[model samples]
Target: MTTTKERALDAAICLAGSQGIRAMTHARVDAAAGLPKGSTSNHFRTRDALLAGVIARIAEGERADLAPAARGPIHSIDEFVDVFTAVVTTLTGPHADRTRARYALFLELSSDPELQAPLRAQRAAFAELARILLAGLGAKHPDAAVEAFMAFGDGLILHRLTVDPGAPVRRSVAIAVRGCLEA
Candidate 1:
């Protein structure tokens, strides 16, 4: 019941999730989407085009996740915690195995430089969003605050990926945030 374009992006997301960006060929995507094997090419002439679509979809989701903070003054550190918690929830899932697999997907992304540009840009956008949030935190150097927060948050995820967390991502973020900021 979906359009060819829809099928193509769906396939791209699932393929990239399961096999990483490099393995997301037209043939693989078509098979994943349950559409004709040539539909990826029919909708997106090249791999770049298909990958672009995938980035667009994922970035859109990321933006949606930060919708509230993006629009308002994110002064309360508590509010950032809420937003970061939701974002981490999406990455980690409600289950431990899903969280581990999501971390693996994060690893898969690191291996695909060609497909990482859009992802990098989206990350910049999130950084800018954090700058806006930092302005509310009474920090004179918004850029520095953004960098610090992102670095700490990312390190937390990477550490959790390699550790056996009894309380999981929500707890991990809480601990990281507490350590990253002062009372």
Candidate 2:
């Protein structure tokens, strides 16, 4: 069984994803998690703490999803593109709510430097993975490639999630990957 803290974090992600972040409150989280009134507050104590926990939970889930791809060396641009295409598909499909919640937090709490580290760190971790893959693939400018790829991926994910759900993810990822490799 999941702990009350885990349930509350899960509920917070759901509430933030479905409802807006502003709609997530201790009472609502408790209600959504099927816990008693003070359960969420007892664990989180503050809104920042709750949000931080949610961030950690999302990162944990993402790490699990990406672990297989991250374990081995990606040999070519095609393989890298395939990995990212799968990432975009998953993020825009089954994991859309979690993606939405994370993006919401990116827009909402980004102004607060203290509260922003978790968000930035999550992206940085992904970027590092990309960097390692690019380096392994012999990209001339691995860091630059990582930056371009991450930026493109972020835009592609947001567009697919909001503007066009059917957008060709593999095509977009391939374009980004090829361009990054060439640059």
Instruction: Provide the overall lDDT of each model, using Cα atoms, as 2-decimal numbers.
Output: 0.66, 0.88
Give the per-residue lDDT digits (tens) of candidate 2, residues 1-183: 999899999999989988979978999999999999999999999998998899899889888768766889988888888887888899888888889999998899978877778778878989999999988887789999998888898999899889999989988788887788789
Model 2, CA-based lDDT: 0.88
Report the lDDT tens digits of candidate 1 across residue range 28-75.
888888888788898789876876676776666667766766777765
Model 1 whole-model lDDT (C-alpha atoms): 0.66
TM-score, model 2 to reference: 0.93
TM-score of each candidate structure, all chains considered together: 0.75, 0.93
- Poorly placed runs, candidate 2 (over 4 Å): none
